[model samples]
Target: MCKSRILLVEGRRTVGGGQIMSRRICDVLSTNYDIAVFLPDGESPLAELLQDYSLHRYPMLEYHSGKKGVSDVCRFIYNMWRTCRVLRRFIRKEDITVVYVQAPSLLPVVVCAVAGMDVQIFVHLHVVHVDRKVRLLLNVCLQQKCVKKIIGVSDFTLQQLSLKNRRKSVVLYNYIDDCIKKTVSSDTCEKPVISVIADVMRIKGHHVLFEALQSSALNVEVLIIGRIVEVDYYKELIDKKYSFQYTFTGYVNDVERYLEQTDLVIVPSVGFETFSLAMVESWGKGIPTIASDLGGMKELVENFLPQYAEILLFSPGNIEELKVKIETILNHDILYREVSEKVHEVAYNNFSKTSFRKKLLGII
Candidate 1:
């Protein structure tokens, strides 16, 4: 059989969910199909990532949001045009069979429409791009004529997508590797550790986490391990000098190292997560999570894996609810231990590398 060529179009170079998703696709299909990925510029963790896999990559114009105004808008448009040019060239050179658009921002649907190549197109909608109220673009490229499949990381995401395009897309729950599982100890001891591992974003609801920690009676030290999305947002919060017993490890490269000692990882987010890699990784490592009952993660924590019931779910942006959830876990050792016992079984069955690879093979 002739190997089908797959091209992934995503924006960033760093190790985030988008890159992780692309890696899985490459891992699954590379054994049977030729694969190449398109990143904004050839300067990302992906460049290093491609070295380890049977994969290839390319660079287009480096698109960075300039100052927030008309200037930024102009810069975005110019970069996208350059990206479209790269797509034209890449299609002719690689003889690609399918192009996967990773995000609405970086890989604009317009490029694929103009490629004029008979390639299958998949839009992996990772977020509800339209703001809180739900907005969408009517680009004909997304219409049935151009695009073939639309993949939403969660069922909640599919509902949001249905708001704009009345098309029914596939819901593929994000997968985690087995390494996320925690080692089972024959002897167990109660350790005091509770944390929220997520990027510092307004919608992610770090404030709710802060409130939860303040309310907890346990000596709960929140290990904050993620990069800042907005400088002003970080500054506003930092200037106040937060009150929780918090160790702000602003953007650590080694999260797993922190996870090793953690008793619980909190994903108290107020916004929509296409899928929380933090939650998946923590669950895999045997560390239980407490998350917000918001968008996609609700399905990830509640329905898919009920064994992780310790992952207390609270209302989105609700500080009081988060406070109660955290207190219950901190106050009860037996409840935490009961859920902890099931972590290895859940992680191995749901997120093992072997299992994830199998899922990918089936998808591709």
Candidate 2:
């Protein structure tokens, strides 16, 4: 008997949680299906790791942070049309029966390409969009007959869709690497080390974290991991007055190594966050986190560690509240150790690679 064919599509040109999950899906599905990866024509960690697979690249237009012009609109339209045409042809030629689109930006074109075809469409959403226009377009596309399932990284992500559109949706939380859990150690430092593992964007609330740390009397150091996605934002962060010492390690491939030294992880995202692999990975290392009580971060803590939600979550962009949470963890050693152990157990039981692989295989 011939195995089924699956085309996994992703639009990002960078390495993030979404790209990692896409790679995970490919690895798990390849056991029972012939996998083909569709990506933007560029050099990225995902691209390099997936070279051994059937990979296809195209000149894809990505939605980034910028002011849109008429020329930009025209270019996006042309690219969308071209991408749809190319994808439809490829699907037909390759005899693909299942199309798994991993990014929301590529959903419109993918929906159009697979419309009225015999193929099944699975859309996996990683980020939560706040823009009304973007949400409207996504809702329309998801309502199509070909879109068999709308998979959200968290339940909060699926809540953003229309009631009618949500009928075909399911929540499949993202998971951390199994090896990360092994890095957990019974380590403690005199001066607590709080690390924020996210790109330097205003939406990530890096300045808010710095401001909170400055007000605290306790001595703490910060490790700002990931690349500076926005230069202006980084400049603003550096120019601010903060008493706590902080270092920026621009785009480190081995993030777990840094987590090993960290006592606490802070996720201060003011904007919509569907899910945070950083927080999960930190937990897998038996590290406690104080995350902004927004979107999926709140959902994860409230659902998984409900008794510790008050200790783990802070109001988004609230300097005083965040400052208090950080101090609370650092001042009490017992509380810190207890939360750490609980998070490690949660990560192992809920966010393990084995659990994710089993569920994904069943979903597809």
Candidate 3:
């Protein structure tokens, strides 16, 4: 018997957790099904990962709420309509059996394209929609007949849906590579080195982390990984006054190389971060981590590892609280090792590629 055909649609062209998750999904599903991915025409690490698969690229305008003028609105609508037409034609021509929308922004267009077709649609949500209008629109689209499953990277992502729509939603955590080995031990560091593996965006809370470190007396180094997606935000961060030593490594392919040097990893997102693969990656390396007690970060601690919630979480945007947490971990070696060992144990057992593939296959 021939395997069924699945089409994965990714809206954003940027390299982020969502794109990385998409690559993981493709890696898992390709063995069982004939896969084709639709992505924007661009040079990115994500595109490179999917190079081995059947790929189709289009000029995709990413969804944003910052549009002001009438022309901007018109252009957005035109692009949406164009994308819908393209998707509709592709589905019919290729006889696709299932359509997986990787980003929530593409949900509206994907729903329209699959209308009146014998295709099952699955939406994979990565971030919580902060805009009420966008949330309402997504809730409506998710209720369509074609949409079979609403998969959230965390339970926090499904909170935006209507109670009725959420009944159809499932929480599937993102995957971490099992091949990641612990190279640098947490006890080996002399001067502490903290790393933040996220794009230099304001919402990612680079400024918040910097502010927390400003009042600290310890001599530590901070490494800001990933590319600068927001240039203005990068400029603002650079202009700020700080006390600690830091370096901005603009987009490195081998993140594991940098992770080898990191003593502690921080996910200081002040915005609607549904899930963070960086935290999982850090834990897989037996590195202690701290994250803002919001969205998926809070959910992961309270739901899975409730015993260590106090040491692992802090209030979002609370500079004093963050600084104290940093000091608490740095001052005590025993406490740091306990968290590191427990974190690595949990991360390794819970987030395996085998488990992720099983859950995803069961859903589809």
Off by over 4 Å in 3: 65-72, 179-187
lDDT, candidate 3, 1-364, per-residue tens: 8889999998766667788888889989988999999887778676887788898876666555432356646655876898888888999999998999997777887888888989999999887776666677889999988899999999888888899888899999998885354744445666789999998888889888898899889788999998998999999888977888899999886788898889899999987678888888888888888999988888888876799899889999998999999989888888888888888888888889999999999999
lDDT of 1 by residue, 1-364 (tens): 7777777776666666766777776776677777777765655666665555534444443434322455545665676666666677767787877777775565453444345567777777776654432233423345655577777777776675544354546776666654545553313534466666776777777777776666655555567787777777777666765455566677665677888877777777766676787877777777667887777777876765665544467778777777777667656667666666565456667766666566556655
**Cα miss at 75, model 2 (Å)?**
3.7
- Which is the winner by lDDT between candidate 1 and candidate 3? 3
* TM-score for all models, in order of appearance: 0.83, 0.94, 0.94
State the displacement of the C-alpha of residue 11, model 3, in Å, after optimal TM-score superposition: 0.4
Model 3 is weakest, by summed lDDT over 10 consecutive residues, at 63-72
lDDT of 1: 0.65
lDDT preference between candidates 1 and 2, better one: 2
Better of 1 and 2 by TM-score: 2
Q: Which residue pairs clash in candidate 2?
A: none
The order by descending TM-score is 3, 2, 1
TM-score for candidate 2: 0.94
Report clashes for each candidate as comma-separated counts. Answer: 6, 0, 0
Candidate 2 lDDT tens digits, 100-176: 99977888888888877898999998877766667788899898888899889999999879999888888888877
